[model samples]
Target: MTIHSSHPFLPPPEDRDPVRRLRGRLPAPVSVWTSSNGPIRGGWTISSMLVADGDPGELVALVNEDADWWDLFRKTRLACVNVLASRQSRVSEVFARVAPSPGGPFRTGEWVDSAYGPRLADAAAWVGVRLVDADPEHSGWGLLVRARIESVDLAEGRIALQHLGGHYS
Candidate 1:
């Protein structure tokens, strides 16, 4: 699978480097990362995330430095990673800023307040995480954020959304 980077979600080749063709071959589950600074909340689509085995448990996620949610996440030092269902592509789009969503994106999904932040009620699963560290210097355009998993909520669901070849698979 080859993604030309001209793929709608990405910028043209000259303007933006092509996403690694191999990345399209490696399918990844779609998820939304949410953060709040008390009065305001924000979220965005994220595919660059993974869990790492450790004593206290941890997860790493790459967040675009330009995103407003990134700043909010830094201030809050907490977040919720919502593993999305296939039917929730629209939810993903809203956060990714691919489509317009009235009343803001949060209104499009059911939300529950959590110790770390907001959890997607209908997400396949969710993890509450507290920021452990952020390596901006080595992260390039995205901030490499490492977090300690504080909690997890699992729910029954089939058909999870996966990203592959520049499109949802």
Candidate 2:
């Protein structure tokens, strides 16, 4: 007996630079992913989040493995992905700061948590999601996190936040 083998239209490995290819894509909307670690906690605003699955409510967020929030997320397995409004640009900046810096922007505000997740009283709107799964592979640092939507709170206005050129506007 003989078996037949066929190769499909597979791109060469050298031609598949996922990071470079993805970077060329336009910047995505930014959101603050908040997680708690007992007495110590932090949150980072990122634009790399993507909706993984819609039926069971799954998502994928590209968070740096070295990010301060990564460990907290790993431990607690819970977080709030806060979608900011156009007027909340300042809040976005606060969470976008690099780690290991004292007096960073996150220190300048009064932050609180809600049933959905952390809430910036001044933010235009926000939502909470419970982390379900995170898979980090070799893709310039990322985690495929599945979360369940807990709640959504919209401020008394409607505005969309956008990110471009490594900045929020």
Candidates' C-alpha lDDT = 0.82, 0.67
Question: What TM-score should be assigned to candidate 2?
Answer: 0.69
> Candidate 1 versus the native: TM-score?
0.83
Q: At residue 136, what lDDT does model 2 achieve? A: 50
If scored against the real structure, what TM-score would every candidate get?
0.83, 0.69
Residues 1-169, candidate 2, lDDT per residue (tens digit)?
5554733554676877777556746767768888765556678887777765465555567777767887787777777777777776776767876433357545645578654445665665566676665555545555545576665667686665877644556
Clashing pairs in 1: none
Worst 10 residues of 2 by lDDT: 1-10
Query: Highest TM-score, which number?
Result: 1
lDDT of 1 by residue, 1-55 (tens): 7756454665555775445755677888899989876768899899887889887
